[model samples]
Target: MEQPLPKSWSIHTRPEVIAKYEILERVGSGAYSDVYRARRLSDNLIVALKEVHDYQSAFREIEALQMLHNCPNIVVLHEYFWREDEDAVLVLEFLRTDLAAVIRDAKKKEGGIRVGEIKRWMLQILCGVDACHRNMIVHRDLKPGNLLVSDDGVLKLADFGQARILMEPGFDGDDDNHQLPVEQNTGYQENVTPPLDVVADAHSLPDQGFNKQVVEDTNREEYLRQLVELKAKRHAVDETDKETNINDGYSSCLATGTISDIDDDPLKSSYSYDAEEGGDGRNGALTSCVGTRWFRAPELLYGSTDYGLEVDLWSLGCIFSELLTLEPLFPGISDIDQLGRIINVLGNLTEEVWPSCCKLPDYKTISFAKIENPTGLEACLPNKSADEISIVKRLVCYNPASRATTMELLNDKYFDEEPLPLPVTELHVPLTKNNHDEDSPGGWHDYDDMGSDSDFGDFGHFKVENTGSGFSMQFS
Candidate 1:
């Protein structure tokens, strides 16, 4: 029998990383990556090293973060390492805690979170999301856990494993004329060259700046060899080990690597909607199987493949609701239960509400009895003022078109009212807790045992009965 590789041989323990940074402790873990708190040996700067096992996710995250490097609300990528045949490692700014921890800490306090503090956090989240949306990127997974807070109370969007670029940066005019080929398996185009401006904007740590040489002479030689090979082929797409299906029980919220192999030549991918076919286009379809069950948008729950930035808006509403109430607004046990919960509150999704409702893949397959007098947002947020309720209402609605954009929400009058959003310096920053605590850095606790998949076993026989006030599921 072959001997198992030692823990020291792990990707995070690569010689290039171990030589330059002192590994402090493992901070977080997930399906595709492991995060560690490390200290740079040269300048003694603390940073998080993310070792990503999945190639495609690493590629997506690296490209997204690089594009949004100048955005204040998005997490900064200090640098990254991606040697051939090795896992990509990202060096990210060290954020002590996340929004989930802040929410958890608020729940323990007497009056819950302060109105001003809530506003500040919400503003930061909106800013980050707005930056992504404006850049034509959609962060498919936008839960509180992915919102990291620095020691100075600055909240930045962190995880981008499920993020997708809607279109090439400058080619936004006509979708019909410029239809880019997309990989059916990965939902991204293969071997597409990145724009010149994007290549020029790629940020990397300066060489020969800090203490001793960051890369040893021997390591530099190896790096140069890899760089030459990468340039020679123009970073050819590696289709091996690609995630073929989005619904393969892999969590989209998993942590991804810091650097990407295809960093220099970012993949150009886009989603196309065919009006005649209802949703999916001939070019390609964006996966609806993204995001956590609770925070997933209604269109995604109903299996709408042709989605856009609006999905993140729905998640933003869910996160804001949790911030206000310290409880998840919709904590459904399964995808079916999730949809049912939405119906129980928002009433049946109809053509009157969303003209494209019938286009959803599962709209006919999974039918629910009409909900009469559905519970309103006011009921869910009884203590919240009308203005607060209105904010949530704009986001959680069935009509994706009606959902408020990040820029619109940022300029809302809610922020102009008394008890205004606290300044970044004055905001209360929560203490970083161990993984065992409920408020782990990246919402680690929330990822465990998120119900079973048995509920989706027989979708053909799926039936949802309206139980007067709520919904109950039955199958035959």
Candidate 2:
């Protein structure tokens, strides 16, 4: 009798045997994954292979990929298969550098951004988010690192690592603990951290009698008590005896992959930095999952139970600002420093903004500093206008409930009257004369509209060029 293979083996493909999809180079890596540039054996098309260690995470990505196949703004997931070694490789469309690298490079060249480019990128991001919302998927993580720019300067949303797939037609993806937060308290309900999620659920639930009784009889006090107990229990493990006020577990998980010895003793880092190391359950990379400290949402940084895609949205807004300013909106050197940075840029959270943060899962440990101090986007991006700042404010609102929705963001005044340029027409990709063969593999610079002859890829050159419409690309 032959041994049976696991259900996951269904998607497996033997790369060694098939002689297709050869690895070109290692381009990217994550906490539990590595991404390589690959070419299709038959079609000779360049693609990206994201290899994952965890089977379930890979499965979840595949599930989401199938749902998002039709969305153009999202990175196209071509196929998924397992190597003979059982390592899963998700064949994705090949794209150029991510926004994080792009912005950093752009900043270094001219030391900042041109307003016109900022407008274009922000609209693109909004379109991407809107597409995700229409598909009923919430990207759990959205940051500069996850955003990739094609060689032609097309911005695409990628990395569905923390994405939540909403069931289409009549399907619901939240059955069992499939969609629950990794750090979700045992007795808690998996309500959406998004304003849309909270509102939709609020309306869906019954308001009278038995439901009322259930709500009343339920010890609101008890659930919080349990959360406190669990948080206490979690803290008690090693550092609990020391009683250091660390926050979420993302930084810690990151450390696990980065450093192993810290697991034993009380390692010393900045207070704010250590706060990030504390994992919020275990949602991010076991190592290097800290995408960007400045882009972290208030809920994740301050500790909120209802945190979810809303956090990602917040990061996107800040990223958009960073692209424009060529600087992080909130570059918190330490965890406490992050709070100050946020307040300085977005204004401090007020009762008028976030009234019930105290009830959140991370609330107890959250130090709600006085609203006496404040941060607003305009102050952070002194070069940006009120309208530009308005867009950021709506997305990065302290109260998750008040944050902007994908739909609302799409309809923002920023895009109210402008036309979004198409890929074939709007992009001005000057293909390198040396790599003119469409069939032959092109180097990174050859494909990039803004890239130079340099190996790292030329970045940050802005020149003003008027378009048919009022909107323009400042690339002179």
Model number with the top TM-score: 1
Runs off by more than 4 Å, candidate 2: 1-18, 83-85, 109-112, 166-172, 175-292, 368-371, 416-476
Error of 1 at 366 (Å): 0.5
Model 1: runs farther than 4 Å from truth? 1-9, 168-283, 435-444, 451-476
Each prediction's TM-score against the native?
Answer: 0.71, 0.61
User: Candidate 1: TM-score?
Assistant: 0.71
Compose the digit string of candidate 1's lDDT tens values, residues 108-221: 679988887787788778878877876678887888767888788877888786677765311111133322222211212233333211111101212111111323556445
Model 2: per-residue lDDT, tens digit, 364-433?
Answer: 4333345554545667767666777888778777766566665455445564333322322243322321
Provide the lDDT at 97 for model 1.
73
For each candidate, the alpha-carbon lDDT, in order, equals 0.63, 0.48
Clashing pairs in 1: 90-258
lDDT for model 1? 0.63
Residue 44 in candidate 2, Cα distance off native in Å: 0.8
